[model samples]
Target: MTRPRATVVSLNQRIRDDIEARIRSGEWPPGHRIPSEHELMARYGCSRMTVNKVLSMLAAHGVIERRRRAGSFVARPHPHIESVALDIADIPLEVTQRGHDYRFQLLSRRKRRPRRGHGPEMQVAGDGSLLVLQSLHLSDSAPFALEERVIGLAAVPQAQQQPFDRIAPGSWLLQHVPWTRAVHRISAVNADAEQARRLQVEAGTACLVIERQTWRGEQPITYVRQMFLGEAYDLVARFAPGRPARRD
Candidate 1:
């Protein structure tokens, strides 16, 4: 029999959304434990069953996690945020959700200033900053793409804590931090010696290049060049048949 005049389902959804928002906002990171059922029940004035339903749903969706006796907690290590498009903004959460054999390698990192010769456009930055991070994105242990990224140390100071071996550069950036704005440019080019060798493809192979300029409010936050082995990937874009397209 159903209970009458109770805020069970509604409360479940409310708490669920709250937890999801926290994760998206980077308050709750990967592999982090979520509140226990008892805590959630008390927090929301709901029953244990209500909290259990919400948590079960989240686990099914690959968001938070649940353990037998350890209780529920946030998932702080799931690598989500790569498979999504550049424009929708949040990418890390998506990458982590995709249960694929993925890996990353850090090639280089440097603290430097943008070259003056590159002109005022590239030279401009908040706090006279730039942290150059070079990395390689991989799937199933095979090199997939090359990343050349410039980070604004002011908005995200811990840019150095990124572990290239465990997180894709894109996933790492989105999950651990937040951005105000970003400009992504995708193009194609023929692979050079270094690119070809790393990608295990023949020289002159066509490759897709993705360039991004990110911002924090009005201040630019990052500039990134992501090069992909084009022949192996197909970038897909989906939309409603009637939704108006957004201008870049």
Candidate 2:
């Protein structure tokens, strides 16, 4: 009896799986060029379209990088930076994933009523009090980022009782609170004296800052500003065109 041949979809998957396996097993390290599409087509006995689709998928997933004329290569790793898409990340987890020890230090904590000069995020508290926190995130005993945050007591009353000494406020809030919407603002700024001292960088060094505010419906939950040494961080966003609908 003769065995049945694999379908086109299976062939594409098999080619993709083989390439990924080689890269993962260290057989094909970062910057190692992958075989050309023609070679893959011949090796798999598949069409150039099928091979191209597999390569496109790999590039989309960051498993490989394609050059205009040099063909594809295993993508180099980014170990110190964190990437996110439409979600908040726990800083501690980000550090650990980069193969470093993570530590959080709470620099200060204060409870006070919102005042006129306190900033717009504070106004969200209305008549309620605010829990303000400043902290440091360290990776392998080196300064990673500095965080300043304010939690609205009216929205999260439980924040008042939490010490926030052992855990960073952002991580704590993500675990305990439910936020429906969030806005992020990214900018570059020269580090001031206080910021430079805390981050252990030279004064006037360029830094990347991310400011975010989250809300649950009409109730504001929290607002935070995080600063990092520019070379130590990166922000990445990926997009692809939507597929056309199929017609029956």
Instruction: Write candidate 2's Cα lDDT for 22-110 as tens digits.
Output: 87677999899999999998899888888999898777656688999999998775553233343566889989998999999999999
For candidate 1, the per-residue lDDT at 215 reads 48
TM-scores of the models, in the order given = 0.57, 0.62
Summed over model 1, clashes come to 21
How does model 2 fare in lDDT? 0.80
lDDT of 1 by residue, 1-248 (tens): 56664455456657876887787876887677787888887888777878888788667545666889997766543343232244533223433345456666788877777777654236334556677778877666777677787777664555655555566556656654444445567888998998888788899999998777764334555777877888766566655555423422
Model 1 per-residue lDDT at 111: 79
Cα deviation in Å at residue 211, candidate 2?
0.2
List candidate 1 segments past 4 Å from native.
1-85, 88-99, 119-124, 161-165, 241-248
Worst 10 residues of 2 by lDDT: 239-248
lDDT of 2 at 136: 96
